[model samples]
Target: MEMKTIYFAGGCFWCMVKPFDSFDGIESVKSGYMGGHIENPTYEQVKTGTTDHLEVVEIIYDDAVFSFDKLLEIFFAQIDPTDAGGQYMDRGTQYRTAVFYTDETQKMKTVNYIESIQDRFDKPIVTEIRPAEVFYLAEDEHQDFYKRNPERYKQEQIDRENYIKTQKNLS
Candidate 1:
């Protein structure tokens, strides 16, 4: 099985990583920063929204285990694509929704994915689908934040998971 990496920014990396990590195809989801102008930006820099970077989660997956299209589908389900500013409970450019494609094929795939859902939203989808830029690993405390802060993270995860599952099941 070939492993591939894709970067995404959908909101708080802590909350965003949970859904993908539970999916069948995903191997791992790592919290980090990417698509920013500052080199090796510190957490402080990103928090201030001065850097070009967005808070992102780097996903590792096996192609055979999960198709890129499937990954994109699950990604869209996690956030309101119509919200251009940021996701729920998270506001700022740093929390903007985005899909960071790594290559031409991935880019085309993302375009198609967005097109497929163009009508579901009243406003145009604001999720930026672009080629991925440099990814900087976040501070140690940020990694596996869900594990470290289980009480809070677990509740959020449960809420998100239930919502997505119900959405899919209803459809």
Candidate 2:
């Protein structure tokens, strides 16, 4: 039961949790702040985009059951990897999409996965692949947000799906 962790910034940490959580072998998905210059940054601080922090999720998964590559596939599918600003209705530097790799293996996997899917989309992927930095767990209220607020989470999923459908039409 070897466990590994990855950090992802895919706009609205709340929205990022559900897709990964739905899969088996995902031990936990914690909403948090990563890549920030300051310590203990609040949501509002990161939201202002001055903290250089991105709203992110720290995902703990069992690698033996689900390979990191599979996770990357799921992650990429759930996000607008080509969107540099944000995902769906969200916008701002703090909402940018990124994969914070914990090691060289993860880095290689992320880069390779991104390249493999290039032909599937019309635009180039702009999602950042960077070294993992300090990850500060968000407030308890933010953790497992989808589980806590199922209706709101469902609506977000609907909105994202509709947005993606609209985006596909334009391309």
Each model's lDDT: 0.85, 0.89
Candidate 2 residue runs with Cα over 4 Å from true position = 165-171
Badly placed stretches (over 4 Å) of model 1 are 155-171
lDDT of 2 by residue, 84-159 (tens): 8878888888999999998899999899888988999888999999999999999999988899999988998899
- Estimate the lDDT of model 1: 0.85
Candidate 2 local Cα displacement, residue 54, angstroms: 1.0
Candidate 1's TM-score reads 0.87
Extract clashing residue pairs from model 1.
36-52, 36-53
